[model samples]
Target chain A: MQVSVKYFASLRELMGEASSVIDIEENISVSELWQSILESKKVVFDNVMMAVNMEYVKSEHQLKSGDEVAFFPPVTGG
Target chain B: MLIEIRKEAFNAYAEMQYYLDELDIDGQYGATASFVGTMRDFNEDKNITSLTLEYYPGMTEKHLETIVNGAIEKWNLLDVLILHRVGKIKIAEDIVLVATWSAHRKDAFESCRVIMEQLKSGAPFWKKEETTTGVKWVEKNTPGF
Candidate 1:
């Protein structure tokens, strides 16, 4: 399955891409998918928030194909 | 009720005036209050430098909308507008624009305050400041935002 991941703030600076499409193993949970991202993009993994379908989610949640995953840094704006 | 989140900068006086007139300002409205948040040159013993802002494109907008709706429900507000800038921003630049109109001055101030407070602890946008020393994440007054 193919999923698009978006990087924001420091994560974007680290990943060097605003968004990317990757093919992952089928039936992967959110936790496993994040682990893969860490393996490939450790810098972003260090400081980021995970979101699926525009909603913040925990690692145990299951991800569906073509989900728009986003990684955001800490809160900044007032 | 109106909500806008974008990367481009906005003129404070122009945006505020235009929105007020467009929303059909209530002549009885005793007060209209605004809370403008700007990018400070320094933070927590850090020297002045540049500021970069980021946000969840989809989630940010959605959350902002919900917040606006909440304010509408709770206050007798005539108008409310939230303008946020994305991408790179400079020091002392206007970062966020929030305005509220109501039948009374107190309501406007209270509503605007509530929106900004909730936005700080609830919005999905994040900021990072880059200085000669190094870059660091911006922290909020309230934890777990």
Candidate 2:
């Protein structure tokens, strides 16, 4: 399976890219995918917010093919 | 319920008037509550010149719709008009407008606050300010409470 991942705000700056499409094994959780990305990028973040397919999701949520996953810093809008 | 993400500046008063005129919900609303947030020229002791706002396009719309829907249900609102700006914004420019209408003042006022607070803390929008020293991404928003 494959998913499109996106980084926003400060996370985008840290990740050094806006978005990417990556192949992933089946039954992969959101946290696992994030860990893999962090490991590969050699970056560390204490926390982040995640969304799957445009909706907020728990880290334990499983990924699916064609899912648009987003990770971003805390929001600051009014 | 109306939710919009704008890439350019907007006048809140004119927008509210136009929205009311278009919807024509005249007799139903006895009270109209609104909150407009503007960019400040200074932040954290830095003189800010402008700001660059960013958001997740599809997800931002969806999240705003959800916020509006929740407010409508909780307050039994007659209507809601929300407009948020993205892209570059100058100092003292209007960044967001949230207006709520209801038969009574309490619901209108409370729901408007709720919506704004929720948006401040939860919405996908992010702001990077052009400060005197350098540009910086806002780490967090003020507490909603």
Candidate 3:
């Protein structure tokens, strides 16, 4: 399956890109996705939070094709 | 009616005037209160050059709406607006705009307090300061829910 992912703040800078489309296996969990990305890239969004399809979802939330996955660093805005 | 997140901003006078105009409507709201948060050049003795504020796009918007709506539910307010700025903001820049309209001073005051307090804690925004020495994240002595 394929999905879109977004990176923000430190995560974006670390990833060296804002977003990208990638291919993954079916029913991939958030943590599993993190491992896969690490294997292919030099990005560290380790402590960051993620959301799937616009909702603040936990990493364990199962992902499907075409979902827009976002990763955010520890929040600071007010 | 405008809840914007911008990279640059002017003084909060315009939003104040805008709210005043709305609240001044006859028999609409008895009182209105406003506050403008500015970026101080010095945060606890740091000669900050600039501030880079980062926010979670979808979550930040949702959190702001939920907070403002919560305030409205608790207070008898007529209207409200919240504006927050992001990106590289210089010292002395206008950081935030908050406004409230209510039936009386009490509601206006309460709503303003709640909104401001919630922003400090709940809004999913982080600040990194570029100071004379180097860049550092602003520490939160008190965390919020």
Best by lDDT: 2
> Which tens-of-lDDT digit does each residue in A1-78 have in candidate 1?
899988776667677889999898888877787788878766435445678998778877787889998776766677
Q: What tens-digit string does per-residue lDDT give for candidate 2 at B1-145?
A: 7899999899888998999998867788899999999889987889999999999999999998898888877887889999999999998789999999999999999999999998988889999999888999988887767
lDDT of 3 by residue, B45-141 (tens): 8899989888877778887887888987899988888888998898788888888888799999888878978877667788889999998877552
Best prediction by DockQ: 2
**DockQ for each of the predicted structures, in order?**
0.53, 0.91, 0.44
Error of 1 at B133 (Å): 3.4
Candidate 3: how many backbone clashes? 4
TM-score of chain B taken alone, every candidate:
0.90, 0.97, 0.89
Worst lDDT 10-window in candidate 2 chain B = B67-76
Which residue pairs show backbone clashes in model 3?
A76-B125, A76-B126, A77-B125, A77-B126
Q: What is the TM-score of each candidate against the true structure?
A: 0.81, 0.97, 0.81
RMSD of each: 3.0, 1.0, 3.0
User: Who is ahead in lDDT, 1 or 2?
Assistant: 2
Where does the lowest 10-residue lDDT sum fall in candidate 2 chain A? A69-78
